[model samples]
Target: MEALFLPQIQQRNGCSPVQPAFPTKVYNGHSQETIHLHPFMIGPVTDTKVSLTISNGPKTLQLEVDLHDTVDQLKKRIMQERKFGGSESISLLYENRELKSSETLGQQNVKNQATLFIVHKCNGG
Candidate 1:
């Protein structure tokens, strides 16, 4: 009824859906005016550590890692478990995205109990 159309009306009025109440700074509106912004540090996010499952065909491996660990670090850990001689031959896939080596677990948006696909990248013959 009215509830259904209310959201549309809010959107038309430019109301943001995902807005957090953060403090705003004042603007002097001058090129010469130097504005320094202090880094706003929020509280630590819960569950800094996460357990990820890597699915490789019939076999699956699970490992616990810190959110700050880079993808290359995860690759090394997997290398220890599997006989993949080199990590270069293998690739990690998450939701159709090929994970980069330098990206951290948090940067890649990896969550707790998340499953990643371990696949072999076919090279040009």
Candidate 2:
């Protein structure tokens, strides 16, 4: 009998596993059969966290966030941590470029342990 093994399918960032459309096939002489593997054999997806260091001049802060978290959410976290007033405008910069509030960390290609800069602007004098 001959057994064929297929390569494991994984999604980007190794966050999840993709199942194949067909099951393992075993061939013996003039006969063929299929075997279904248990779902536990495929393993489970682990929760991956992205850590970022945000710097505002001499002060710095560390944040743990998900890849799907948007820049706006991150800004809110920063505001809460820093206790900034509502009139304060917060800007996040990664690699010297300003990050959009609607964009996610994954969309921005922000890797773990990446350093970001914070710029604060107060509306009205």
| Local distance difference test scores for all models | 0.73, 0.76
TM-score for every candidate vs. truth?
0.59, 0.64
**Model number with the top TM-score:** 2
lDDT of 1: 0.73
Per residue, candidate 1 scores C-alpha lDDT tens digits across 1-125 of 11111122123233344233444343434443323423355898587799999988877888999999999899889988864445557788988898888999899898899998888767895
lDDT (Cα, 0-100) at 112 in candidate 1: 93
* Tens-place lDDT digits, model 2, residues 11-124: 455244444655634455564433334334557775658899988887888999998999999998988896444537889999989998999988998889999898886668
Q: What C-alpha lDDT, on a 0 to 100 scale, does residue 1 get in candidate 1? A: 15
Best by lDDT: 2
